[model samples]
Target: MADGASGLGDQARAEAYALPLEDLNPGDPELFRTDTHWPYFERLRAEAPVHWCKESEFGSYWSVTRYNDIMSVDTNHQVFSSGAALGGITIRDARPDLRRPSFIAMDPPKHDVQRKTVSPIVAPANLAVMEPIIRERAGRILDELPVGEVFNWVDRVSIELTTQMLATLFDFPFEERRRLTHWSDVATCLPMPGALCETEDARQAELMECLAVFTDLWNQRVNKPPAGDLVSMMAHSDATRDMTPDEYLGNIILLIVGGNDTTRNSISGGLYALNKFPAEYDKLRANPGLIPNMVPEIIRWQTPLAHMRRTALVDTEIAGQPIAKGDKVVMWYVSGNRDEAVIENPEAFRIDRERPRQHLSFGFGIHRCVGNRLAELQLKIVWEEILKRFRHIEVVAEPKRVRSSFVKGYEELPVVIHA
Candidate 1:
């Protein structure tokens, strides 16, 4: 079933998307910058949950803003395949062969096997072993925040904790943790036009450099005997039988990028939300048990990753909107988080609000984020540590958002810490 309205011509679709009160110019590439999502997503979700967008740099695509529509696309992976385009998931049309293929972009049976291989490591049983270590690290990170002084939380604390934990999972050498973190940042920030490098050639080189570093790391891990870690689990698992070395390298990059960035974003984003809503902050501080409820509220308020694009495999209609096969349909999680129908007073950030975690920040369906529980765990423990140490935390400077639209939360978040 195609959407009721046939696919409009480029001009008409663009005109339809030209709404008032939008800070973004959908006609420009910045509207779909790979680093950040708020400006464009805020506009689209407010104006058109199912609107069309086109930029000279990235071409045309349909943006799904409604919660139900986004959920439909996310759930119906068959009708809306992750494997549609040759390039990877971002809206920017990546060069087909140059883009690394991860299970994140694979469809069906292949995705199933790959996901299964790594799922056990993140299962409740294994993650239980990590809880104490994670709690200790969280305490150290928060406790070390300069008392009665201002510090940049994003770089100094948030990213450090997330990537360090990921390093532990891979058993990466301590000195190499920062490099792996840098690689994840580069891979996710690819669609940003000049965030890292000026030219496409330079961008491709940087990407390959990250891939090569990851490949070297994976080969070393494979050569060694099995260990009780994610790398060893994947290497020894029967589920990965047909997986080639390249695919392992690709998926390793995927897991690192996925695991590191999103959790880092959640931590920093949670800080932002608390600062944004002092009442909510007060609530959490007064009743630390509210931390559980606050976790979802923070995710909802942050809506960190924004939108993920899925290509229509077969023609389909969603919410009376017709989507053609191969058409790129983007589900705007940021908008879905603010959906009025699903969330009462969606704009309000209330920690005590029931079901605060209902926002589609982790997405839905088969491709829903796998490290979601871990990310939530990190947020919980980090906040617990923060509350135990600091009586008051306030933003000292305006936060800096990433330049790209893909993996977004914060680049610089300076905060004044009070004991």
Candidate 2:
């Protein structure tokens, strides 16, 4: 660990963190609002390390900003419970109490059982079998891009690519795949202003609409014979130990949101990064094998999903700060990845950095992202296809970022592809 203060030792730093959480404000723009996490975490990482702030809307909560502290909380599941907090994993609770719960919000042993149902479907081996399909779809999508013309890359490529892949995974009717996309959009895109309407009634209505579509799919999968795809795998995989229809629906919703949101974000974000740094793009084009290293660097730079919240189950101390029982503590992965204590010159994006893959975008410990390898695979293949097909890709318009803070994704990316 890079010492927070190189001039001092661990003992002095731990002593500073013993200060009260009330001294720091976690509800600031960087911490409270989801628009961006870096500014708030950077300050916390440097200042309080473990601090708390009160929010006008949500209650007061502790913010764990340092890399070591975030990793400590993430790995110590016994001390910090993922399920104890409201709405579970994410800090914001935009969904109505009656709304469905995804696996991200649930803690074991239910989380364990539900994850196992479809875990095999996304396992590395399964993804190896899935590579050709993803690559083929990726090729088809890239081939359709308007050469020598400007188009919105987010819709034309990123979103469509992930959505189509997901449709094939669930065996949904091609045209109807947009329905799955819509459900995921509303479910994860909540909390942002205009995401769900300002009114609770309006938000509930949107959620109900999303739920209706998922319910239809669940029934369809249940009634049909085994098809060897994900839906069938979830339906018949050890029913005695598997999720109930409700639980299955929730977990499926989780998978859709996880798969669509992050993968699409990486696609769009990587393009934006490459466009912003033409030198990096040139470097990548010169040596295509750099795609593997570049993929992790992109994930680290984008940090698609921001901080994940965990509640301290029993009173515990992280990096010497005492966390009370039931206190809401966030593992600010966004800050950790950029921590000066860990990554050297953390802010700059270097494609050929000796250790570009050291960051924690997929997370750490037992709850690390299950589809991590698949995400990386998609990134590498997408870049490979783009490099082969196009001589240059430039961003023609400022990319519109998603309103939600939880998912730092590009909502629209206008690009001109010159083949």
The lDDT, on a scale of 0 to 1, for candidate 2 is 0.72
Each candidate structure's TM-score, on Cα atoms with residue i matched to residue i, is 0.88, 0.87
Q: Write the per-residue lDDT of candidate 1 for residues 1-419, one digit (tens) a residue.
A: 12212232343345534645332433243333332233445556666567765543566678787788789889987787776245456666667765556788888898898898888767898789889999998887776678778789898888899988988888878777887777777666643354766666776677677667655666676778877767777767787635665576678778887888788888887877777777878888889999888887888887777678887877888777677877777777877888887889987888899888788988899988898888888888888888877878887655777755556568788887766
**CA lDDT of every candidate:** 0.73, 0.72
lDDT of 1: 0.73
Deviation from native of the Cα of residue 215 in model 1, angstroms: 3.0
* Candidate 2, run of 10 with poorest lDDT: 1-10
Q: RMSD for each model, in Å, please?
A: 6.8, 6.3
Q: What lDDT is reached at residue 377 by model 2?
A: 85
> 362 in model 1: Cα distance from truth in Å?
0.8
User: What's model 1's TM-score?
Assistant: 0.88
